[model samples]
Target: MSTDSVLRFITAGSVDDGKSTLIGRLLFDSQSLLADQVAALYHGKHKRTADGVPDFAQLTDGLAAEREQGITIDVAYRYFATPARKFIIADTPGHEQYTRNMVTGASTADAAIILIDATRLDYSEHTPALLPQTRRHSAILKLLGTAHIIVAVNKLDLLDYSEEKFNAIKRAYSKLASALDLHHISYVPISALNGDNIVTASAHMLWYQGQPLLRLLENLPVANRNSQLLSAPALFPVQRVARLDGSSADDFRGYQGRLEQGSLCVGDSIRIEPAGQNSTITAIYTPAGQVEQAQAGSVLTIVLADDIDISRGDSIVAADSTLQPTRNISASVCWFDSKPLNATRRYWLKHTTQTVYTRIRQVDYLLDVQSLNHRQDSDSLQLNDIGRIQLSVQKPIVATTYQANPATGAFILIDEATNHTVAAGMITSLV
Candidate 1:
């Protein structure tokens, strides 16, 4: 990875699962907070318990809803820099009503930290109502979209810091991970609220030897050009059409848009899809000034060599690598509406800048997260219910399966009457 690129990670788990405290520990013990900020946090309760330790989760829980209720309700972003790397942590809410919030956070994350309470490792007991654990097939289902994982079996103090207890939880979670085809997951036993084995090593777990949590985060392997940047096709989705009032002497026009994929440079011949227009890059202008070249992830306005009817909601791609365009597709939909997925219903599909009408064609199977099996006869999926749905759109849109390209695989279902987001979906298989 280059210095300009940033690796984003999201923290997820059940309510009271210690997500906030873990993140607060990462920031505080790494010396990321300033003196005044630290002082404010120190005086929150104005007194410490007999343990003489300040509650670190106080740092991240700033909103009154979070502080008063003592639970995370919204996504909070934290930024910090180490000598070797820069990091962005997206702390998402864990309540079932906020499953949409979890999806909102995880969509851009390169990794996920799944925190599990060691004391609440009860598999035999069933949650009385299905609503309590909506869409969770255990932790695995909540995290299948994530590329990498770090399972923090937190609150080890409640377990007397026992290695046996930690290992049991680890083994069980690992088994569920393997069943879900979740890869590259590592585990650590730590007490989030107390800050042991997170930013520093612990004396209680003398038998265990490994990098501390902060060290693990700093050294985690990140993929570079060879995998994500270079191998994929060049895609430039028009976010906006930058028009400069009038045309030149001969009515010369240029289509302005940002590069959304691989590098695009001057003199490179590209084709605009759906329109089938051919053009060459004539100029690249960053807000700073004109640049001779640009690469993936850059937001620059461009000028074309030939006249083309390019507009927002359209895409420009490399001549040789045009992504498949489709009207019917299969997606992994996480139901976000209070009402169940009305199978006989239709909604608006928003992909990038384009919005089209769409209808659910079929519901293949819903996942049973714990066992990671398919619950075959699901009639409907209510709020936070995740299931496989076949969709038929009114117009063709460009998208690849998430495994191929995450940004391209995304789409949104909007309620036509309310204009509210009703579902968050990822294109799992483009049919």
Candidate 2:
């Protein structure tokens, strides 16, 4: 597959907003479904909608529990390709309790299709009425750094494909999108059930002039990690040690990892972190063969001139431009576990490859999803709560602010005793 041909995106919205159906329609209309899969849609005890057509939502709601409950409980990923582009769709749950799943799905998305049910709104005066879940998902997307956002106004068939209703939603959501500072924001009227404005234009909605959902996604530009190279140096968070026992070289040791950002070449001076030792790149090897250089996304084995004391969590960065190791950091955190995050609690912080014990120094404030306002009096972060917190790590970690370089700036808070991931955090500043 071509590098630019693949687009990783997710579907998110309030419950019963047709997120799964939208995905099923995208797959079905694209002719990506197999004959047996199509047969199951008709044969299984699967329920059909009021229109007498098989419920396309069944395509994604694969779990028996999900089919019985008629709600997406976990993240369902589907793959499809058009003549123009290949897509990896993450169908995320829309319930309030499953907000963490949506965040996890959208973390790597190039764009997001947020489905807003048109029937729920009063289309008289161009007003946009949204559920609380909508606001929560929007807030999390902003925090997670999802760049492209397309608001898909779904269930237009229920509204008789009225242009006024679609326009009203567009106006209302455009205001909200502006408030969230989302880039490349666009609106489309679609009915996932009837296949209107999905893969092709809907005849009922001739008044609306916009590309279909699939086309818009195909045209959207993927974020270029290599573009950030000018500002940040190559960052390699060692995943494992690669040792080869061969006839010619008995002591061939290489560090293996994905080159997260920037670029690296042979003979460049690199600094290994936590210990802060300097070495030169003796060789760069890929599966095909050794190459002169590698870009941001390549995973390769790098042999250093000097065998230094390096482990899985240590980072190798350009010597001239390296992240400063620090113990205290202020970050924006999304609490996901059942346990609330309190200032007195200690957790395991996994940043890049390094795992260290960390304590919550302070809970600065909790963000109100609807208004995007910060409440200062909060002492703890509940499930799916977004808050800013101060953390004091047991050991210093080489890092940069998330905005500067995402590869080196993101981390997860894990429960030390249970080993469950409790929160996802982004470094805002070094303290």
Candidate 3:
């Protein structure tokens, strides 16, 4: 399938906010389910609704623990296609403990659907307060640079489809969005159980004039990496160095990796990062054969004119690219491990294909997810904590600010002793 024709999005909200049910409803209503799937829903051991209808949430709550507890625990991915667009939906856990899973699912999403349960709110208040998980998910989405956000106010049927309650919840969330500086937001009242405002318009509430959830998704524009100009700086992180055995006189070496950004052409002058070695692109080869040029997202083997030492974890970029090699960096990170972040502990900082030993220079501040406030007194970050911190790597690495280029700018921290990933971070600036 063409990359441009696909849209990747995630459904996130507090536990029991109807994320799974909403996805099941979308798939069922769009006629994307097969006969066996439909039969399993009806005959499955999971309990049905009072009206004897199949349990929609059972379709996505595939894990035994999840089905037993009726809560999402892991990131569940589902795929479906409509006439207008193809969709890859990630159903993420809403529990705070699984915040890391949600971050992993949303990292690549072009858009996000944040579900808000109407039953939990007190509509009598002028501005209904949103749950903390709701705020946390929104904050992560903003940090990940998810361009489009849809506020799905779910279970409105329980509120008798009250327009006032929906408006109150919307008002409360609007303030939160403004504080977080989130943009391109759309609000829709939905009842995943009753199939309202999902794939088609709901007859129960004519007050909402916006398009149904499916229609909006079908029309939302997908981010096309190729849309950038050809002259844009290119980033190619070498994944592997291929050495082919040819004739005794012919020695062949090729660098294999994906073009993360911009373009690469034959005869273009390129520089290897960290080493600062310059070379000319002698040839470019794709799976099909040699190519004169390759754009972003292409996986090809590059043969350079010079035999300068290059290997895995090294990056190749246009010689004129402005990216700087730095050893110190300031970044915003979301701590995922149960153990708090220790300033003196050594960690493995993996960026692109390169993994370097790093130390935390300082914990600048911890961000309050609910209020979007930064606490300056924070010395360490605990599980599910988002904070700004400075890090010093053992070796210089080429990188840019996350806002400038996410592919080359984001990285993960791994515990050296345990080797488990402890945090996900985005480069804010090179220090």
Q: Kindly give the number of clashing pairs for every candidate.
A: 2, 0, 0
Candidate 3 Cα deviation (angstroms), residue 56: 1.2
- For model 3, what is the C-alpha lDDT against the true structure? 0.90
Ranking by lDDT: 3, 2, 1
What does candidate 2 score on TM?
Answer: 0.92
Name the regions of candidate 2 deviating beyond 4 angstroms: 1-4, 50-52, 122-126, 244-249
Worst 10 residues of 2 by lDDT: 223-232
- Residue 342's lDDT within candidate 2 is 61
TM-scores of all predicted structures:
0.89, 0.92, 0.96
C-alpha lDDT of candidate 1 relative to the true structure: 0.74
Q: What's the distance in Å from true for residue 224, model 3?
A: 1.0
Between prediction 1 and prediction 3, the one with superior TM-score is: 3
What C-alpha lDDT, on a 0 to 100 scale, does residue 92 get in candidate 3? Answer: 97
Candidate 2 structure lDDT: 0.86
